[model samples]
Target chain A: MIVVGLLALILAFDVAHAGEIVALPNEEPSLVLQEPNECLQGNSYCAVRTSERRKFKWIEKSATLTMDWQTLLLRLEPGVFRLISGNLWVSPQKGQSEILTVETEAAQFSSRYEFWIRREESQILILSVRGPVEIRLRGDSQVYVLESGFQNWISRVDRRGRAQMGIPRAIDIESHIEVWARLFPGSRTEFRAALEEWRPIWLNAVGLSSEIHQELVHHRELAMAREHRSKKAQAEARASENQRLRELFRQKVLLE
Target chain B: MTRFVLFILCLTLALIEVRSYFHNYFSQSDRLRGEVGKLKERLARETLRRDLMAHQLDDFRQVVATLLPEALKPQRSNRADDYPLRNLATIVFEQKSLNLGLERAGVLFSKAKTHFQQGEYERSNRIFSSLIQNYPDTVHLAESYFLLAEGQFQAGDFEGSVRNLDAMITLFPESSLTGYGMLRLGKIFESQDRFEDAEVVYRTISKMFKDESMLVQEAQSRLKAVEL
Candidate 1:
């Protein structure tokens, strides 16, 4: 009986020490577990209400959280989250992680966008940031991917029942990072660090720095100005003849 | 011997238990240390990235400062003041009476046309110029302007011709002469090797005055020529 009791104690100790003890990196909790409820049988999901005014971040393992209206920064382990209505910014991390699926509504349009990042060949990270966000239009069975970037209109079903996507334009990544930084007051440093790393990459992809883009834009403006000047010169010469014709019509045609 | 074997087995089990306890504790500590090392490396990378960005920003600023001033250099004015006949028209307009009758304007326009036909372009130009200034309210104003521009073209004063032709179209947009004036402008542009301008004028005439079959044909031909 004593031997069995000692074995029970050892078994309890082993169970306690089996899993890796992952302490919260921050002294302050990364996420607030508001209105925590007991998980259902055979499921490890947390049920919590979200609001637009509230900010949330993921700092640990995979778990389901429902967001009604909130901004979430996924700077932790890759996990799936059901965002009923809100924006989420996922930062790229080192090493392979699970495929993150975010069911969220687009900011500008009232359409569902399923954003997912999956590993390709265990190395290449194929991030479908904007495009490949599976969108199924109302009354259509065919699903279409949102063309990359923030779009003005949602993909809609045509008369033939095929999904039609609008032209995709490049999104302003820096502005997005800035918005993310503003939302997370506590993780401002980390967000800014991510921004610092990603900004140059984005800029290089687009061509040059913002300053250089501005210069190129200015050159375009100058070309437009030159065209305007040419047109103006042509118009000025025509003004005198117009004045003459108007006066002629008044004095000769009208008066007579 | 069996008691000794049992004691040896117990001692081995106890030793294993002690070793496992220390191993678990040290492994946890090691894992934490690994995490800390990773964080430090990330921090260092972040610092280096920031420094690189700062350098790039500086380079961009330098490039902008160097190129912006030259790019934004003030374009020279192409006003009437740059022309020799700048004040001549103004002087004539100020000196002439504003109440000339339509008959008198008609006579003046005919005289200008006569001089232009006789190849006395300078004399025709002067008459046409005075007719415009004095009879700014005449019905023959568009005709007078067209004749003056023709005289200018004959005299190799292409700029002056362009000015007058443009004025004719602007002033009398509804007049049949405007279509002809646009065609002439296109020809002038073609002669000057300004094919784009010629093409634009031709396209404008062709598209805007589709009812004028002759003008459309002429513009289409010119457009094709310029495209070539």
Candidate 2:
């Protein structure tokens, strides 16, 4: 009886220990940063900054943009900024033909956000701060900017502003009665920064004078004035033509 | 010698019974313990997995904070390379499992867009026509039909534009671009000096896009033009 009791005890101990010895296969989780969603925020397209060697990925369901690293730049066209989250400031950069969309996602405390990045070439820059940024590339190699911060998102600038770039026609100051300067808010920082950076860079790289700066400003003003006058004249002409038609109709009815 | 033999037999019987009892008892306990250990390990692994996921989220947040500002800065211009449209289409198709219905419609629409951009009206028309014929149920069919109508209008094919516009309006009544389609139809009527028909479309858009400045302005302009 004692022998049997001792054996039973040993067997029970063995059973308990055996349960503790069994184990399962281990699985490690992934550590890669991937795009959060689809439907990228901002404009439909932005300039391709190929020199930056940036890769942008888009998630189709949620609009967001994810950047691989810093030195990647994207911009939005004018009148294309839709408020997604946080505070955004927009301004027209001097001597450029595009709008700048700047966003600060620092203040509002929220992890969920949407971003869209369309890769194209133009001056417009769209910036979305503090949101998941989606980057969509349709074809070809695309270049982008990855700003360093906790806030993420893509700001797009459409390519429609290409037509408004530098004038293709030769200008004759004599034929041009007035010149107006039209400043597009494409890159609020870059275009303005470029101008600020240009003088120093130009003097160092090529060389420039105060006279040249004045001349540049003068030409810009002339272009803006000319565009304004042309638009006004066209509107007036349309109105006048309408009035003429009205008078002619009145006269014909009376004569009849 | 007899006592020795009896003792041996009893010892053997005891050994067998003890072994059997131990096996039966411990076998069940061993299985139960194994299950318990498995549960414990699973709990530990899940905790680790959750922590890893949280860490990944934190890393993504850090990356976003660093990358967005850089994107807004002016970037250096890239060299122009010929974009392989065909290769891109293939890649997109492969990724989406080559949903043939969607792919063919996409091809037709792409062809139409390319032609339209290049100002090849007749070719665009042909492509859009084929799309409309093959995949009338395609989501892009509405857009294709709209493009066909626009192409016709630009090519001065007013009757053709009207026909396609009518089809777009009737077939895809729920399309978001249908408003623009309606606007185009109004413009077509205006061009033909059919003031009454133009007025109907303008008024409809005015009701649909209420408080939308651009559409409202367009409707107002068309209304004024028709009223005069």
Candidate 3:
């Protein structure tokens, strides 16, 4: 009985640790903060500052987003993923798109299916990965449509200053994709798996190419299995935690 | 004298072994106790961290919910702190989505029924599973699940049949076909020789659905059979 209890307690601890918030490492002052709206608390903006190495798992309703990126100040507005600056992966959890508008520093990307976006200091690069992406630059009135494997660049300011009007057509994204693949291997796997699943789907109304798709699927499957196992763990942790809090409150009540 | 010395030595050795065994046991117990204490501490820290994250997530979701178009916003409970009125836009979209789902489910249900009639139980089950998973809110939900279970029972999938029947009954308790579903479930239990279970189901049907004379009569007969 003691052994069983010890094992359960250990498992509970593991569960608690999994869900526990990791203090932002002192690598740099991290800022993942939220200020609630006065009208209705927490009915507004969400700020996240993630280091390059760590992935932040966020649950929005039933959908889950694991954000892994570099030098990003991302704001998740409703039906909109607003990137203030830096790179962001805009792929939905599954190949399924909630059709969220991907907005960056100088351009807005919208797609029927999926699109990926990135922003440098002054220029925003939009990658149309799978379906047709409609890109609207900050100042441009006309919407530029880009197909898969193509990218468009828009600058906030040119040498002369002011939002630079994008006169050039979108170019091929092969070189850019290669650079990104090397930079963000994990995200690359995700994009590839999604690409593989959807590519076949795209070709034959079938969908994924990239051999990397299998790896990504495997990774996701493992995570899912772990999550499934840990769901009970989480429940146990919550129960115990709530019990402890309840006891504390009761003690205070008794004192009064 | 030699035999006495040997017995004495044997007793001392046995005593020493027992002493060591207990020493090890107590040490193990102490270690485990220490581990449990550590585990509790870790759990406390973990819960606190998780709580912080949960708060942030809730805050973020709230903002997102506010920004969502009225049509897309989730249904709200009629609570004091919540807006009770359903948005007009939601009505339109909900109708559209629900209509689409109902249409799709209707098509699948029809297909499954045809398969069931044809004795193609496997094919029917495939369609039923798809329907149950995707179109749970289908208009013929109770019938769909019940028929699925009936088909499984015919196909010798007794466990599957029981599960589906249970789900159907539980999910659609107030459904018009619930009485029939209970009758079928009771019959299944009786066939499986689970007399007690069958009797319980029949009794429940007889008492719970008194308005349905035919159903009550059938359940009472089944209950008598199980009792016998």
Encode model 1's per-residue lDDT on B8-96: one tens digit a residue. Answer: 66865796589687876877766776687668545644653454456346435434433433333336355766453333333333423
| Native contacts present in each candidate (fraction) | 0.00, 0.00, 0.00
Please tell me the interface RMSD, in Å, for model 2: 15.2
Residues A113-153 of candidate 1 have per-residue lDDT tens digits of: 22222211211111233323454443345555443333223
Candidate structures ordered by lDDT, highest first:
3, 1, 2
Look at candidate 1 and tell me the lDDT of residue A154: 41
List residue ranges in candidate 1 displaced over 4 A: A1-256, B1-100
lDDT of 3 by residue, B1-228 (tens): 788767766765675577556755865645655576666545544653464466456445434443345424456565554543344344435757678778889888888878976879899988998898998776667667867877787788988988987887778887535666677777777777888988888898888888867668868876887787
Indicate which candidate wins on lDDT.
Answer: 3
**Which segments of candidate 3 are over 4 A away from where they belong?**
A1-43, A57-66, A74-76, A157-162, A165-256, B1-228
Clashing pairs in 1: A237-B167, A238-B166, A238-B167, A241-B171, A242-B171, A247-B137, A248-B137, A248-B138, A248-B139
For each candidate in turn, the TM-score is 0.27, 0.27, 0.30
Q: Which is the winner by DockQ between candidate 2 and candidate 3? A: 2
| Whole-structure CA lDDT of model 1 | 0.55
- Chain B vs. true chain B: TM-score per candidate: 0.55, 0.54, 0.55
**Native contacts kept (model 3):** 0.00
Docking verdict class for candidate 2: incorrect
User: What does candidate 3's lDDT look like per residue over A141-223, in tens digits?
Assistant: 67877666555577653222223534323333455455445444366669687446644433432122333356678899999
